[model samples]
Target chain A: MRKGFRTDLRWSDVTPKEKWLNRRQLMAGAGALVLAAPALAQGTAAPGRYSTDEPPTSLEDISGYNNFYEFGYDKEDPARLAQGLTVDPWSVVIDGLVDRPGTYALDDLLSGVTLEERIYRFRCVEAWSMVVPWVGFELAALLGRVGVQPGARYVAFETLLRPEEMPGQRGGTIEWPYREGLRLDEAMHPLTLLATGIYNEPLPKQNGAPIRLVVPWKYGFKSIKSIVRISLVADRPQTTWNMLQPNEYGFYSNVNPQVDHPRWSQASERRVGGGLLAPRIDTLMFNGYADEVASLYAGMDLTRDF
Target chain B: MDGAASLNGALRRVPVWAVCGLGLVPLAVLVWRGLSGGLGIDPVKTLEHQLGLTALQLLLAGLVVTPLRRWTGVNLIRYRRAIGLLAFLYAALHLLVWLWLDLQLRWSEIGADLVKRPYVIVGMLGFACLVPLAMTSNGWSVRRLGAAAWQRLHRLAYAAVLLAALHYLLLVKVWSAEPLLYALAAAGLVALRWLWRRGRSGTVRA
Candidate 1:
């Protein structure tokens, strides 16, 4: 879309996929680290295709801090409480306006497709950020396989709502089975990833195990976690935060520094592991995926929809 | 000689210095946590939030002293100034952390934030109310303004505490028990003050 945009860079130039896969097998054979063994067994993703130049926040910080309200409200609650979650037997139901719609097991769904690493800049609506290396395939790949109908204009998602499993549900703060939606165009964008892991390992339960959506252009909340259902719809679908507080959290929620949150400024963001005195840096529009996704919004008013 | 002797007596009765030491415990713990890496991934935010909460907690503690004296007959009036001053210290630390650590001394941005962020506006209003209170916490100011005027001016604490509590409530994106509990506590303190005034008025009528 613009001169010198990275679309020209081949995947092999960015990442030597074969060597990365071999390294994983080598590590698995040697059993170098106890913690890394199980993660490798699940199939380690090749080095990332699209990587943000920013330093990745530490594995400790990425895993430790989270806003999986299904686990709890506090930042650390998910890491502490999500251990009990059962994700190995997970399945996602696809229905509504699709040619093929059925409940598909996580492993069965991902069996044929290749998962590549995507290093993305994650900007939360709360004005904090991290650069995460997510392992997943493009949502478009899955949508293509499922065959989106001509009538479908929106894609809706739902998170697991088990009260016993997700302790935060007991608080009754938001309607359970957290829901989020995106325009069909947004869903099919190249940057839209259905992530299964981060940091070259299978996602920890706290970090949205099995599967989650990662729309790098939008606020982190729009990347719904621990997804249970995805439905293609004709009408605009309701989202969790939008339904909860329409004024504060909007449907678009594209990370725009100019559009400030009601409680705080979105112009700058604190890097997650950036210690006590770390200076907050300016936030980028569309979380720095403007080249790939900006045209999708074209003439639409993001401020009104945001 | 008599005034000097009464000052000494007041200090001994209330142990104001000891209360001040107790007030510093939160800051000490915060510093210790900072040095030891106990402050999780986002230490800056942890420091900012913990200091603000400490300030609010101390302010709430200061509000309780008047009621404690009235209902339980515990004359802690001497320690009130010490508690109020300590609360101001924490509030000042909170603001400094936000400005220096979070905003990195971007004066123009800070000015913009003050106008844009309602929580910051209310927090600043509470801090503004404290400036006069802290400036006049001494006996000289009481004597200068007359005790009636000084007490009336210090009554701004009730308003400051309310604003600070509101700042916390508005800052939190989610409705949780903790911030709500602080709001309830502040409200309860204000209600107690009103009830005490009503009881005094009834006694005057009698």
Candidate 2:
């Protein structure tokens, strides 16, 4: 009975051909609508709407699709098989160029420390990427507590080597006892975190359980997993990938799109789970953290140094 | 001897149409599952994994036909066409899932991915080799091409099998034991074929 909402209709609005094209257009429009509707609804939402300053990316996605060489060389193998590993009763042997040198249990190291969540864009050397909300204190903070000496120019991290735990170690696809290294300055960067947990949970076995390093500016592999030792050395330490293919993987291993990997292009990265139509996002210099960390390698040629 | 005779009678009685339909069952099931939303939430991953596994299964089945014929003297020649066609069906499914769900009709991206990813390149090469084998499976093509030429062209299936295995291996960021085992099995089949050829030629010369 209320005439207030009465709508005006024209004869042209109901044409059969137009209706058919409209249906086709509606079908075509559905894809864009699916992607856009949620974003729009959440834009000017209620007071209790959950939000975080962190980017819409997660460490779970990154860690879930890891290629941990120590566990296995397969991308999904670590996720499938690393669950067999025992992460508890783990201890890290910290020595060399530090004032205090002794073994520290993983729990003891993690118990009293304050953990903070920092959202980071992780770029893999293979040119895929994800946003990760990593929970850990700065590596510099931990190093400060350990008291590093002036002569320490590099920091080397080593993964555990028990063939019983890591079955891949039984066969020699790579030299056993995987190792990764970082320059002293790189290790001391504020963003570098010795991560022990992610997404408010203990690190998954596949994602370098017990402990791992997170150097955000570099390629993902530079962040070593299942670390058993951290040694401060006076010389540059030999990294596993660098040792394997010196030309392809350099010691620095910064995320530089211009410097392509030998087998693949590094100019762009596919955000996993992004539907087929989502164009690969162009990779940024230093993985979009260039402003914060590029000063560390101000003059060095990244292509050559890498 | 009685069982063998019955099997021969069964083979003779079973209509070719029925065998063809049976051969198509795997593809039909896949299509049904794909349309019914039974392939799980991530359709692409589900399809990719299923097609990949099926491709491996069909390849192994094709390999087994030869050894089985020799070992049991079962005359498995009748099954060879069906097995090869099934292999092509799985391979076609694999390519379709990749093109539709993974690449999504982005011709440029598809082209780029095929060129950029070594695994994709190898997979395309394997699929290319399968086209000829599938086309020439019919009796008409065999007769038109002549038996000698037909045999020569169909021999490309061996190369297709190897390429498919390589494609699987190269796809993963790191090597897994499962795929490696498949590669070893494929390699063993190829080795057996080579050994059989050598033995046959040696016997002929003697």
lDDT of 1 by residue, A2-91 (tens): 111123533333324345545545654775476354443444554455667566777788999999999888889999999999987888
Q: Which CAPRI category fits model 1?
A: medium
What candidate 2 gets wrong by more than 4 Å, as runs, is A1-66, A69-88, A107-113, A125-128, A167-172, A243-248, A273-280, A299-301, B1-8, B11-46, B103-118, B172-176, B191-206
lDDT of 1 by residue, B1-206 (tens): 55545655665765668899989998999999999999988898899999999999989989987676555555567788998999999999999999999888878779998998899999999999999999999999999999889988998999999999999999887788899999999999988777767778454110
Candidate 1 C-alpha error for residue A152, in Å: 0.6
Q: Candidate 2, residues A82-144: lDDT per residue as tens digits?
A: 988987778899999999889988766665556665657778886667766555667787788
Candidate 2 residue pairs in clash (backbone atoms < 3 Å): A73-B174, A74-B174, A250-A306
Distance from true position, residue A87, model 2, in Å? 3.9
On a 0 to 100 scale, what is the lDDT of residue A21 in model 1? 44
What's model 2's lDDT at B68? 64
TM-score of each: 0.88, 0.75
Give the Å shift of residue B151 in candidate 2: 2.2
